[model samples]
Target: MTRKKNSGDFLKECMADALFILLRTKSIEEITVSEITALANVSRITYYRNFTSKEKVIEFKLDKLISQWIHEHPRKESASAYESSLSFFQFFYSIHDIVQTLIRANLSVMLLNRLILKFHDFNTPDRNEYYRQIFISFGLCGIILTWMDNGMKESPEQMAETVSRRFFPQPEP
Candidate 1:
């Protein structure tokens, strides 16, 4: 038997859809919770129950997308940085539509902030290691933003190879 979505779950999905639809034409700041609820056909109470603000809705959707990617692509036993970077670009390529939309909507910072939070090692007490993780996260975000800005014409494989060559240039024969 198939499980049915609970009311809150259904409402959250509606709100997210409404937000995305509105975002297509309106900036996030211009979107009000009332507008979201009205468009979603949900109640103000329902919106507040699921999200704190309009930005939270975007954050929720971003987290959902990232979670889906992580589930679909399990990490290797000992994946190299290049392998990870390939997967990274591949994931963005798969979601390029939404990525582009977010970029156009000027909400890409939410994506960057989310990435930084995901890469954060709360358990690590070493400052240098923490800094390294932040640096990598920022670097990846920069690459994605640039790619989206440039229309993302290159294939994910090409982007991955370019990044690899940049850091590990081949010596002249």
Candidate 2:
């Protein structure tokens, strides 16, 4: 049973990888299941078994990537906006190629929506604080999307500093 599950997981990963590779040169709508299956060296039945559509495959990949990112970063509620933004930009920059492809395809909203959902903190005790987290999630998503749109010219440190200054202004002396 474990072996079967592992094989299924492997096939799903292969299909997801193939779709992203094709996405670099072709829009998501332009690439069909046949193309993905061909590139992945898998059968149509395999593709159908694993994913409902190309969009589903992309969502699966994004979810996996976000899960990995969360595990690695483990967001701290105590971290300042600058620290959080720095890590966010650094991580996204590392995967900028995949991001750029998604942007070019006009599917950037997928990233934004996924990030908003993933960044939410479920354990918040106060309803107001929960809403605050939601707002922060949207704000963070906006900042990253804008950075990607502008070709991410600034270094992560530069971007983080700019965001920190704008969002959390210091009082005058």
Q: Which predicted model would earn the best lDDT?
A: 2
TM-score of each: 0.85, 0.87
Residue pairs with backbone overlap in model 1: none
- Candidate 2, overall lDDT? 0.87
**Candidate 1: regions farther than 4 A off:** 1-7, 168-173
- After superposition on all CA atoms, how large is the RMSD of candidate 2? 2.3
lDDT of model 1 at residue 138? Answer: 86
* Per-residue alpha-carbon lDDT of candidate 2 for residues 71-134, written as tens digits (9 for 90 to 100): 9999798998789879888989988887888888888889877886787765878989888877
lDDT of 2 at 145: 77
Off by over 4 Å in 2: 122-127, 170-173
lDDT of 1 by residue, 17-67 (tens): 899989889898898899999999988998988898888898887887887
Q: Candidate 1: global Cα-lDDT?
A: 0.83
Taking all chains together, the TM-score of candidate 2 against the true structure is 0.87
